[model samples]
Target: MKIAIIGTRGIPNHYGGFEQITEQLATGLVERGHSVTVYNSHNHPNVAKSWKGVSIQHCYDPEHMLGTAGQFVYDLNCIRHARKNNFDVWLFMGYTSSSVWHSFFPKNSIIVSNMDGMEWKRTKYAKTVQRFLKYAEKLAVKHSHFHIADSPAIKDYLDKKYSVNAKFIPYGAVLPAASEEETLRQYNLAKDDYFLLIARMEPENNVEMILDGFSASNCKKNFLVIGKTENKFGKRLVGKYGSDNRIKFLGAIFDQETVHALRANAQLYFHGHSVGGTNPSLLEAMASGSLIAAHDNIFNKAVLGNDAFYFDCAACVKALLEKTVCTETKKTFTRNNTEKIRQQYSWDKIIDAYENYFFECCQSAKNESYVSSKRWACK
Candidate 1:
């Protein structure tokens, strides 16, 4: 099958979850003997025509200059390109900006949209923006041939709200080995010496709350906040807790190997994301055998299950830390989480699921095309 993947920054994945998933999915599909083309942003640092056997097509993205509005134009450009490509399927990763053009999607290709977290419910967006997002989501649901929800909770919500049957297929990750001692030394980090929080310093991520709770804790380990500190929320977090020498705000480390190393050695990995389903970072932390203290939400609960320590507020973070400093020393959670990743969330199984879905959709599409042709001939 010839598949065209859209709605991501690029393949080499200097961006977030969608891009990472696209990189994995596209490359994996290509390796499985399918022709896959991943649409990229022209703004992406790497401008290669192809990366690891997957074809690349760059579209103009002015997010750096126009901000959120630029994404709409970028998606338009991708849609234009996709319409001309005549691919068997178009896999759109998200609906944030692309849903508005849903009606313009190529008629020959079966459109599959991945329903990412409840974007409208995110706390950061304004009321008007949230309403617009809801409308866009509706359009996506109505126009797409199939809905892919990364979490069961998301699938259930979409099914109830739209009265549509959406497929539930969570994101995937590879189980990581132990951290390299040399990699740990580069950051002056040691095995289990620090608690880590790796996420964009956004308000929705509960970044400030995590820092506040850590500051409140009497625990001995350092709290390392990974991700960029240049944003307003990040800078505000620094101003509020920067003086607390215990909190180390190690800004965005993009290298996957480095991130896996950090996760492997962390005493505790705090996943405070409240917006998304099956977060890539959370899976990475689990794969690396990190003991997790995730925000208690249906999304995280579904992924971590009983293997993680849950927290709802600053007090909860403080309590979890205090416990970890003492009796929470057992490696049972880490062992169980790693096993979960190995058994359930491996990328190999995820790619197979996608392959099976693709072929099913393709065969259904062919039958529909045949029926449509017959109707036209009779008319």
Candidate 2:
């Protein structure tokens, strides 16, 4: 099948979750004998025409200059280019910027969209922007021929809200071979000596709340925050906690090996994302065998189940920080999480699921086309 993947910065994964997943999925599909093309922002670091057997299509992206509005232009560029390709399947990774141009999608292609998290619920956006996102979500559902939900909770919501059977296909992670202790030396950290939190520093991510809880706690261990701090919320967090010698704000670190090492060695990993589906970071932490303390919400609970600790408020985070758990219990939790990744969220399994689903969608499209032609003949 000829597949075109849109709605991400690009393949070699210089950015975040969607790009990483797209890189993996596109390469995987190509390896399985399908022709796959991934749309990349012209500003993306990787300028190559192909990477690991997957084709790359670069489009103009002006987000650096025009800010968020530039994303619409980039999507339009990608969609316009895609219309001429005659792809069998067009997989849209998200609906936020591209759904508004649904009318321009190729008439003959099967449209399959991976509806990302509930964007309207995010506190980062203004009320008007949230309303626009809600409208965009509805438009995506109304126009797409098929849908995918990364979390079961999201699938349930889409099914109830739009009366569509959205497929549940969560993100996948690669299990680390072993902990790279050397990676920790650069940060001046030793094994299990620090508590780690890695997030976008957004309000909904609860970075401030976690830091507040950590600061209020009596634990003597250092707290490491990993993410870009140039944003308004991040600057506020730095100002509020920068004076604390124990609280270190390490800017965004994209090296997967270093990140995995940090997660594997941390005394505890805090996941505060309350707005998204199966988060890539959470899965990586699990795959790295990190003992997690996720925000108490359906999305996190659906992934962690009974394996990790949960926190709702600052007080809950404080209590968890101060509480002592036996080594046996910690081992049990980390073991369960790692096993979950190995069994359920491995990259190979996710790739197979997507491959099979694409085949199914293509077959259904063919059947519908045949039936329509037969009815026309009868007429």
C-alpha TM-score for every candidate: 0.95, 0.97
The TM-score that candidate 2 achieves is 0.97
Candidate 1, residue 179: lDDT: 49
Candidate 2: tens digits of C-alpha lDDT, residues 98-124:
999988987778889999999999999
Candidate 1 achieves a global lDDT of 0.86
Q: List the residue pairs that clash in candidate 2.
A: none
Clashes of 2: 0
Candidate 1 residue runs with Cα over 4 Å from true position: 324-329, 368-379
In order, the Cα lDDT scores of the candidates are 0.86, 0.91
CA RMSD (A), model 2: 3.0
Per-residue CA lDDT of model 1 for 1-379, tens digit only, reads 8899999988898979999889889999989898899999998988999999999999999988998999999999999988887687789999999999976787667889998999999887899999999999999998888889999899999999999888888889987655478789898988888899999988889988888898998887788889998877788888999688989988888887888998888888899999878899999999887888899899999988888888889998988888734334447788788888888889988898888887776666666661122211100
Error of 1 at 291 (Å): 0.6
- Ten-residue region with minimum lDDT total, candidate 1: 370-379
